[model samples]
Target chain A: MTETAPRPTLEAVAARAGVSRATVSRVVNGGDGVRGPLVERVRRAVEELGYVPNQAARSLVTKRHDAVAVVVAEPETRVFADPFFALQLRGISKELTAHDSQLVLLLTEGRADHARVGRYLAGGHVDGALVFSLHLDDPLPELVQRAGVPTVFGGRPGWGEGTRSAVYVDSDNRGGARDAVRHLVGLGRRRIAHITGALDQTSAVDRLDGFRDVMVDAAPGLIAEGDFTPAGGERAMGELLERCPDLDAVFAANDLTASGALRVLRAQGRRVPEDVAVIGFDDMLPVAEQTDPPLTTVRQDIEEMGRLMARLLLRGLRGRGGEPGVGGTPSSVVLPTTLVRRASA
Target chain B: MTETAPRPTLEAVAARAGVSRATVSRVVNGGDGVRGPLVERVRRAVEELGYVPNQAARSLVTKRHDAVAVVVAEPETRVFADPFFALQLRGISKELTAHDSQLVLLLTEGRADHARVGRYLAGGHVDGALVFSLHLDDPLPELVQRAGVPTVFGGRPGWGEGTRSAVYVDSDNRGGARDAVRHLVGLGRRRIAHITGALDQTSAVDRLDGFRDVMVDAAPGLIAEGDFTPAGGERAMGELLERCPDLDAVFAANDLTASGALRVLRAQGRRVPEDVAVIGFDDMLPVAEQTDPPLTTVRQDIEEMGRLMARLLLRGLRGRGGEPGVGGTPSSVVLPTTLVRRASA
Candidate 1:
């Protein structure tokens, strides 16, 4: 049992602040109608008393939990090994902390976990949700929509139904890939090969689209499939070499794959920059800088995307979307990515 | 607002299963006394009806929110840069998911946030808490203890008051450090230098103690303090070399620090292993395997430690704590660490 001390109530805070209980309650629940002086007094009294705003009490008034669930649907170990999700989470944490809202993390590994998460979200346990890494066949996006919780996706949802009206924060994967390929083209490299991430994800598919945007009518042998792993990158690079032995430039889906490509190129006695220029996406520092020759890759503001997801969700929750219960269509965000110059490219 | 579809209640589940409401409740809440056949029937009914347990009703019955708050109280950006917290979070999430519980992540940056966290824990919002990376001067431990919430520390709590009876899960840092030093000694390196992590953290302090156990009368100049970052490691390695030019081996506190030391050694024209046999701790794969000569380091089961902490906390919450309200004294767990020998050492 928790220590048996009774917590200070709104009445206590009101008494200390010389204000009405109603005023204290209003201030605690975002101070909608409370005046500035009264709000300041109530806040000071609450702070002095070390009082925590009771979610139960607050829910009784607003019917809101002031909590958001971040659902990450990743069945593959490859995503977990990279720092992409972690960096995004840091941004989300910082933003949510500033908002004084709690973060509930829900990680779904497979079909069963997805169903479980769908049920939890449907149970009205949280005010909103931030769902991430949805594959082409994932049912989570639709499930969340059916649950009717205001949600902001981390990336563009790949599934067809219900996502056309959905809000999401995504980096310009297509444009970033275009920039990378353009940089390689500007370097006087004629035969450029492309190594793609797992095609199931929209991020990878979008990058491939961007690659095709620049490399119009390129030889089919110049493309190889990689699952965004170092080993996968090495294998893909080897296959690309076998098919196009004279290829002078390579663009990988992510830094991990590019690092693997770098190792294979080094082992095959191909000097970076001199013999072959390499560029990757998602400039993950550990992988990019640790490469024999530091990698030049596309940089996405991952943490900022996380922050934006929370900011948008919270704004919707604040009734800024429209009427109190009928949250209007929340705006979606697409952040731009820049090419980070390094020795490899 | 959430979809208006009425959630199936306990009465509905009971009616569907042809059993009493109490029996359905027991099955839903872990099937404590319900028989196998009846439990099966209730589960099927639950599945058929899509019955999601109402947290409000459950709290009224069992006085538990079925939520665990994970408090990470590191003010430094270095901790966020690495993937350490993410791996631990994955382990905790998996365990919590298996147990049908939710995770509320509380990230505290400084003193003000600490107070906010303390009040939240005191407000009885969660059933328990798992706090990590506690500094010696941290007030969170005391606040948690006073709240009377069952907590499982990720590392040993550093405070003196109210923590003697606290439960925790930790890796054997001392033993791991001793093994690293012994391996170097076996390699016929007499003059070895040590780079210590921040002394405020118990992990670093325990590691330093282990180094002292192995090098009883070593020169004071051989030990340099690092803040568990790459830059700190570089500075420490530089200082160690300037002070003791004859040192043949170096044991860094963690892999990030060791990576920095490796760069410094390379820049100073010192051939690794031949001139300076370097070992690191944590064996964080991204840093360890990606280093110039892959690092040989101490391997602590960080994810396992996270899993164990959740397991212990859940076991305590299941009324194994003697009285229903008065949780019994939970035992602490200290997991062993092994040395992963690679080319560096």
Candidate 2:
């Protein structure tokens, strides 16, 4: 192995610059009470010796770590594969990097890992947190809120109520669902069945409610539950077909589920758009664009949502209070969704 | 906003425990000079006050951060969607968490972010680094090596040479590709085509080399470049068909690319397996299993590869020298891959 030289010490730099150790420390920590000549000499010595101050020492002086925790309360491997997770992280990563703040990720294995995250937050390891607690049953929001860290949620946390201090950034899931259903209705499809996502998640419940909002007092047989996977979509589609063979259109909760439904429709000899118009949420390009006939779906800015979460957290950290729509108590931002028309619907 | 009580100070904990400030500090920093009863009293006071030792002060005494940086030099959004990245992260995250360390993710946007990453590493912000520098021209490996933190690479690295100190964890790309081609050969396939991933990456380059090993002196027209994307597969497959209309089989660089090839095959009226056999690398289940005819491909334990990298880095940090296959100098582990047969082949 190639031997690596030990990190250059402050003493080494001081000796090279012909200055005292205190002077070198003063120059490195913003050059307070130091002359310009001494500072320049110290800086040149630092550059020449590749000297970098220990983060621990610098952090002690500043009383802050320029880092934020992105805690994800997801144990399932499925979520990791979802482009939704990846894109959101990218957005957050980009935003944090631009602010010169590091992203310290904390992935929890559901309830079992919640305490660890709680301790980490209370430990002052990071300045703030952006938490993703997707399920209504997830107790993470409460734990995180109790930790007393300035936090912004990724989605409308599943507690199903307005909390004055809970700040969150979410897309208009219910509104998007309404748009998908309305589009199906505009295409003259009345008996439109719905394939919902995992009911545990607020997004799915809201989407189902959106379907109900448009199809008020609709037939009970018109909806089937899905777990937001292709296999789940396939099973729900088969069940829907058995229950209502004459249904004219279908709106799936997300693109992956819609693709699965497409397969079942194709297998059952139903031509998409001709026999059954299909629309999905989250116009996740890879799946939405690659489906058999392509899929007409709702497009939410997933990456933008991530960026907004970081922005909101950073703003809060800067102590900018009472900013409308964000950076204050009761802060919330709901991004709008758009309908992307394709051959499927 | 609900008010958060201030963090309890070390002095407060000492006063609560009815002990000297020095005794409380000693107990908190592992109780070397304190008796068992005094340590127990300090512990109770800490638990009651919910006191967490300041990381900066602790690090000042211990000279360790108990954190590892996972540096990925990928600017594009594509890799995030690739399960390879997510699964690997999950693996590394799990290992680090179990060891009571944190994972600091550094997502680089190519060259512009390289200097920042180097500075972060050299700043002694983390105990070590696990770097993923996929491209050949990536200057990251050199920068990281110069930073001199104990490090491990994700893939075999693109430099294509044996370095005595370069430690990495990579799947057996060449061997996996060999097995894929052998399966085609067993099925009496001739005029086999190869759709290569981005040649800048070592994994893609190795897979391409593997194909050449099986079909020595094969026609140059049989090979086409792909960027390890579904769209790339579609484009490369079309070119291959145009150049050699009678091509009987294809080995795509990865599953996403193979799915694209499958779509093109369906569009071109070529019956899969019957008319044109297809196989892909990296059996990314969501893509591989969802393809029209499903996909026959090589399966690499991506998550396990991630775990191995973390394990090796941790072992090296422990200063456990000369453990074979890992932890010593030239620590590298090439995990084997297997062919998963499905409907496509």
Candidate 3:
């Protein structure tokens, strides 16, 4: 982000007029309550220097850029390939666009980018920020917090403990996972296996917790760790099958993983929903709908979540740092998820 | 984009020092070739008014924002759903990150955004711009050209005719399509069909042109229009199959379209490669590799194209608009594509 060009400043105007900076500021800001002679002198100085009051006032006093920084702290660009990132960004972009605000997408890659993002957030270029800090140890949460800008996390921040007041918008990962597992139980699935996303992420952790909430006494062989990818799902599924060949149900962390699991199951000559049923999370459109049997998974309104995050942030910024949200401090919001039944389950 | 806050201007310092603006500029910029008394007077004035020399010089003279605008003139958010967008953006981001420049993404929606983008480019907020204007009727090319900013197009700009001097980086869509069709012909398959992408986009149009380059005067029933989506491919493939049941091979404009076509063929009990040798362009990894029998497609280096676009734009900006490329104008580059054969073809 950059300014158009250098312009005359109040300090310079005051220096030229041999007046105090405060007097120049007062005269420039409509000359309200300032002496007539002082106003005349300031006006003459401003005229000579070509000073534009609105530019300075808008940037300095009001501090409105009409731009919001969307910080994605993912190290890899693979996030772009995921429909979840796309849908969520669509939601955020639409919301911000509606508000006459520009979206400054800050794609932070690796450790070096952390400081860059931190500096950018603190640089006061954008009025506020909407960040995604999915991993448990992601430094984005702390850096953005330290930046002292009004920020809303895209998902639940994983910088655990003591930060209860952090504002966020997230899908009900635990509840959704619980519903997915319980749905399998309703189908009389006994040896139900769970394929987890990378444990480093809070969403994956919550999902695993949800699975545990239902199958408290399930065998150790029933749970397999995945990395929220098709390959990870395939590997996890293969592991679960080898350990417990009779597992009748598989619950994947996301649609991508589930798609991979589906491929593996088909390769092994198992009939989906007959010999084994599968349920994925995130109900990603093409992945879920285009799968061989289509996917029965938990539906999280990703775009809506993005829109809500922006809406919340804008609401917090409503009074321009005054009168905050409904209860003064903008609180975290957890959106509910739906179990969309399809042919797979 | 914003400034930190207003500070003392050189004009004001000159005024305070009772010297010429040029004298102040020279004194502030290291006091080179300026008289000692004038330099001392400017230095005192600068200190008194708290003016920063580098900030002014950087923003005004050199005009190095260290920021590049990536203007994606896409009305619908569906572009985000495409893996092509992800890969290209990843390439651009990585390149910009390496160059210590910020990627300021400008996602324009509908007619209103055209002027906004034009204004931003002309506003000189960024040092340069990388624009994507795929649709033939897109107003972006004209607007950006009118803005007079050094810009590089991500794809061949659709502002046809009299744009011979325009700089762009594109995959050899036509050549790639020709190769794909030629390969299908080598497989001893006649009565081949083609699934085209949305004809409005240059990539799709080029692919269609490429298909016709080989087929020449094939039956009208052999060509179907797809919107570069699996659903579109499915719809087009259904139409083609209905029109020409004896067609032995299918060439799709893109991987997404091919995926859709494959699904339709499978539902109709047609065996790929054996019954219909299927080929798709843009060998998108997961989409091409994950298909049932896998797909043999034309592989264009999308990421490399993105990197090259940035590189070209940066080259044009090398001397801050003084000197351009080797021949005074940055010439457009067209990257070659290769046929990636898998099980399907």
Cα-based lDDT for every prediction: 0.82, 0.82, 0.80
lDDT of 3 by residue, A1-345 (tens): 011235556688999998998888777654478888878888899878756553213344556656788877676475575667878888988898888777767764565777667655554456788887457676666566655568888878776531346778999999999999999999999999999998988899999999999999989899999999899999999999999999999999999999999999999999999999999999889889999899999999998999999998888787445763444546789999999999999
lDDT tens digits by residue: candidate 2, A1-345? 223557688999999999999999988877489999988999999999878776567756754667788887676365475677878888898998898877766654446766666765655557788887467656566556556677888887767332345778999999999999999999999999999999988889999999999999679999999988899999999999999999999999999999999999999999999999999999897889999999999999989998999988888777644446553443689999999999999
Total backbone clashes of candidate 3, pairs 3 or more residues apart or in separate chains: 0
Q: Which digits, one per residue and each the tens of the lDDT, describe model 3 over residues B36-136? A: 88888888998787565432123455456667888776763755767787788788888888987777776644667666566555544567888774577
**Highest TM-score among the candidates is held by which one?**
2
Q: For candidate 3, what's the RMSD?
A: 9.2
Taking the true A–B contacts (Cα pairs closer than 8 Å), what share appears in each candidate?
A: 0.09, 0.26, 0.08
Model 3: per-residue Cα lDDT at residue B168: 84
Scanning candidate 1 chain A in windows of ten residues, the lowest lDDT window is A1-10
Top candidate when judged by DockQ against the true structure: 2
Q: How high is each candidate's TM-score?
A: 0.79, 0.81, 0.73
Label model 2 with its docking quality class. acceptable
For candidate 2, report its TM-score: 0.81
Provide the lDDT at A297 for model 3. 99
Estimate, for each residue in B55-129, the C-alpha lDDT of model 2 and write its tens digit: 557757755667788887676365565667877888988888788766767665456777767766765567788
